[model samples]
Target: MHTGLHFISGLPRSGSALLAALLRQNPDVHAGITSPIGSLISMLLREMSQGNESAIFIDDTQRKAILRGVFDGYYGAISQTQTVFDTNRLWCAKLNVVAALFPNAKVVCCVRHLPWVLDSIERLTQQNRWELSKIFNFDPGGTVYSRVEGLVSSSGLVGFAYNALKQAMHSEESDRLLLVSYETLTREPQRALDAIYDFTGLPPFQHDFESVTLDANEFDARLGTPGLHKVGNAVRPNERQSILPPDLWRRFEVDSFWSEPAWNLRGVRIV
Candidate 1:
């Protein structure tokens, strides 16, 4: 069987982890959190392997180090499984790079409402030690800066990331890609899981769907509040309660260039 790679990407606080956790329930799938740095390294390595002079050169150990560096202390240690699922929120725009490396890789882009995404990001910034500004490289003035600045200033980077992913889905290879909304997943997890299983060709596992909800509170608590040790350090609650006031939400506009009507299409509901 060919080993498959599934990229579970989305805006921060958009339930990438939740989706990963649900997919991890399948015995045939090894889904875990990864980072953009890993995607970059993989792309570079792939390019070099293809005899592309524009790519950088590094020894085997050095190459492994680069990959490992992106995942904190767990570099190059990813188990060789039949199917590896990388659930990284930062892999939103970077998917293009990853696609170049693994042309056959399957992508699952998760999305959430723009207003809620911004609200969640704002809350996370105030409550957690993590800095969204630094992560997204936001700036008030600068060409590249404006791209993400608009998101941070209004709906937050989550919206920007969602838009980027949508654009990526338009590629000729998009049929191999799956776009999953966070709301749909939450409302009907089993149905979502079933779709995922079909997409990845994984045999069903005899696990309770409710088991995926094990850390519901701990996960919710991290949004805007302090992190709980039990649920792992990664999860956080929304700090701002709401990202947009009623007036702001009304005034906030979705750029025509960034809208994806395909996302509005109703698909299978996994309720």
Candidate 2:
């Protein structure tokens, strides 16, 4: 029973994927692209809730067991020898469940400036000119403005993740959360990794930032977005001019709440 578990979550287009790739270098750790366990847990919860006619037969204790078993069954074999770090944007929204199930688990959130996050996604969409992105429901028509609007809508990817992070920041479990800014992760990867190790209560291990590698071609292809999870051979800042219109870029300038110290009421650790 490998009880050592943690989570990797935060906004997309951040460095979650890259962090996972770098963490893979550690022989004692296990991490990868987002997994289906988050969705699976939701489905299981619904099935065991009052929505199900058979819910009367399942008790609270059994419910907890089933939920915990999902983690055990999914990663038990590999986690027996290595610490597990599950990746999912939904984890931030489910901190209450996390507390009940994995009380000691820490959540490492990869964050970035809101404008840059949107810019990265927009660049990916443009790169795949011939295909429709599942991010926008695979619709064939929409301008950059429209796409941006849709992505920041209440239920949109960026919007939802951003909102969930805010919710996590104010939760009682906020102390269990660690925010790793994309800039630091890229420009000062060693320091970022050191903070992460300290947060997760693990010993440090050497990581080859210069040779970090990841392949998500098949996954990105299915989503009609190429190189979405691609990582460079070296972990260094890739500064570039923003392709977004001036007005659009400026609109989200104030959205990176994590950058503002005043917004961190809970004093959640930020790297």
Candidate 3:
């Protein structure tokens, strides 16, 4: 009774959680809320790095249990006909590292405009107990947020993330994947959900579209002033404005080393 694995990945705040939450409403789908295996795997990597001698082994039953645990924790309890979904930001990267482990895994990569993505990240840093370095695993004293801000403002981070995404898309197992954009999903949610349903082989659910709209004030609160300041004007920019500040956008355009045809190849226009 092994349901196939489905992954929803994207840049931070690109609606991965929203998508997962929406998909969970479907009776035939069970999304993992907490993935113990992923957590364990992360801990195992940390242990190994610290020279700990703990051996992590996976057998068939254990694998099934881990998958089931992931399903129940994130999406809810699994049913007989349910397709399990694991929605996490870094899951795609982990999926790439262990592609062979799950033969029938399906990956969905979510994308958002670079400017908006950077803006969202910046906003989060300014509000609450924002710690960019801790989240990104950088030194506590390092200027990680500032550096990231520079990269995003200059559009360099977009290309880097896009390239990484492209590499994931081009894997030999690429057919079992789908690439989606946040703008499309936000604007035409029904259409986007329909596409996601088709891709994941799940039936559609009764979704609350109105409840999902992005809240400007709330978003700003989470992001803070400095983060909001950098990409504030770029939110849902018009075509002309999409050409962000020239110097920064040009970096990714000209860098051959960072470019990947499969990943960077533009699909449908999002905005």
Candidate 4:
């Protein structure tokens, strides 16, 4: 067996938690709101393979076992029988590591346009205007320009995942990657789920759209974001207009790089 493991990753605020909540409705699948495993994986990758001279002593076998162990260690609480879906915004960047550890694993990536991704975060920050979300801690005093720049920088939230997803789209293991666009997920969820189920060879389960929910209050509050991972019991389109300044939103209006016809040849099956 291939460990019955998979991942949910891509842009934040792009319905990753909602997807997890819907999938968790499946009795045989164990899905959770965003997990820290991706951060842990990144830490291990740097420590074991990139940092100090001692990393030279860590061969591929040992590195693989250690990296793979992070999943076993964090998910040790779940019964081995349940199919697992780990969520992280960074997993798209680490497909190479995942391929090494779990060859059969697939990553269900949720992506949104860059302008909307920025708009979504801005809306949340404005909602909690009195407080600061830790997400912007690196640049607490940044204005809309700085914030957008930071977020779209090479290592920023959207840029890193965008580059990584593009890389994974072209990698030899491309077959194991599935892209679920935020628009498609919201407007046509059944089609999105169907594509996901078919991609991973998981028997399709009817997810109750109206009854889906995932409570992440404690975690969200700790990060000073009260509704960061909140999902409605029912999945619906977000008709809310961007609360960001019109100029800011307009500046990033052309953020949907994946929509280009040239990208169609990359072999990424976007739903």
Candidate 5:
């Protein structure tokens, strides 16, 4: 019995893996660490575009059907009654294709403060001081200004996802989107889980918050990050000081754009 598909997306280092880990506790849901389906979405879109597969007799309707099959075929391995959630930072950018292919699908964006997100990355870099991370392409030459510019620039990682999220929040499918904040997700997990269960319409499972843990070393290593997705074995308040210089951190803390009054007007719910 096939159920439906939703997405776990938004900024990296913002609890996407933690959400997937907790959701997996529900036997009825098939959620996991970031999946490659988003990349596949882009790949298929290019393959099916006008100058490509369209010239080979494949039409738009057939293309849409085939694209839908990709989800079915990929997650078809999960058992009956299980909901599918493919995690990726790229899904926020692919929401249009998602709304078209799986009209009922929702994208649950994992969000955190931009300054803290950058601080988290910096902490990891310092902890692994002996080695350079692929996150910065192993280049450690830049000053704080340049490094930040790389992240907030239009083509940068966070910039791109933030733009994509803003687009989805204003879209006609805004009702299908949910923003899950990291602070609430880790602090008051029961409330967070309840909200997630209601949003995705999945049967609730008794999650063991005290013993929650996920190991992503093998996968993280592939991306040149060892503990990028690591979380405490328990869901509890995580308090830590920023290792970044005060001035550097202040530059990115200027705004909490996602929670501003303007988005409320668009009817996108933030919890």
Candidate 6:
């Protein structure tokens, strides 16, 4: 069955996985950890572009239809009553494509402080000391400085998403975007969820903050970074000292553009 489609995207180590777990509490909502649908869409676009010799054979109408079918076919098995919220970090960069395909769909971006985001990833890396992380291409060895540098490189995981999110905030379709802060979500989940419900035009449902749970153990295991997506059985802030050195922390502090109101030129909603 087919129904409205929304998206969950934002920085890594943010509350996206937690948000998906909570959103799933509402029977009408269907969401999960990041899916390959975004990558699939990207691949399809590249294949249809001039990079492929067969591109000349496909018209814009056909291209649009094919892209739309990706969503339909991906969630085609879900019940018609459910509103699908696909999770992917690439959606922020593809807002124009999404706007054309599903004008009403809103993108909920979960964000966190840049330093803490890096700290979270570092924590996971340290915990899995026995295994090399797929994040760094399993490169065997490097100091925290090198790792932090790699992460903030333009094409790196955090860097690309950060840039894409900034792009979305200033986009003409900014009204269709919502930023969910990790602090706000952990300290005031109900408030964040209320804003999300209003933005997506979905009826509110009570979520058990004390019983939230999501197990992506296998997924993280495959990535060689266990607990990467594990948010525990409860939705609460886990306060701790930043493992990041003060120098490194300060270096990336300025990268958190979402913290500044002036950067939000299009008035993208933040919760």
lDDT of 4 by residue, 1-271 (tens): 2378999987777889889988888988889887888888778878986667899889988988888787888878574778899988677777777887888899998888878888888778768777787777734577777777877788877778778777777777777788898899888889999999998889988777778789999998888878999898788888887767888888878766667668756567888
> Candidate 4's error at 97, in angstroms?
1.3
Kindly list the per-residue Cα lDDT of model 3 for residues 1-271, writing each as its tens digit. Answer: 4655677765555666556656666667765332345666566455544254442454455654554454455434353467877655455456544465566677776776555565455445445354333333333343434445444442343444555555655555556557667776666667777887777666666677544322234443343422221222122322334323455445434433212355334342122
Residue pairs in collision within model 2: none
- Candidate 4 stretches with Cα past 4 Å from truth are 77-79, 138-140
Show pairs that collide, candidate 4.
none
* Model 1: per-residue Cα lDDT over 177-199, one tens digit each: 66666666666666666776777
- Tell me the tens digit of each residue's lDDT in model 6 across 1-271: 3547899998999999999999998888889999989989999999999999999999999999999988878788684778999999999999999899998889999999999999999888888899999999999989888998899888898999999998898888888899999999999999999999999999888899999878898999999888888887888888999999999998888877887898888888898
TM-score of 2: 0.98
Give TM-scores for every candidate, taking all chains together and pairing residue i with residue i: 0.62, 0.98, 0.62, 0.92, 0.93, 0.98
Give a tens-digit lDDT track for model 5, residues 1-271.
2547889998877888899889887777888897777778788878877758454788789888888787877877683567888898877776778888877788899999888887777677677666667877878687656666787777787788778887777777778888999998989888888888888887666788988777888887876767888878899877988877888778778655787886566777678
For residue 107, what is the lDDT in candidate 1?
72
Highest lDDT scorer: 2
**Models ranked on TM-score:** 2, 6, 5, 4, 1, 3
lDDT of candidate 3?
0.52
Clashes of each: 13, 0, 10, 0, 0, 0
Candidate 5 regions exceeding 4 Å error are 51-56
- lDDT (CA) for every model shown? 0.54, 0.93, 0.52, 0.81, 0.80, 0.91
Cα lDDT, model 5, residue 26: 77
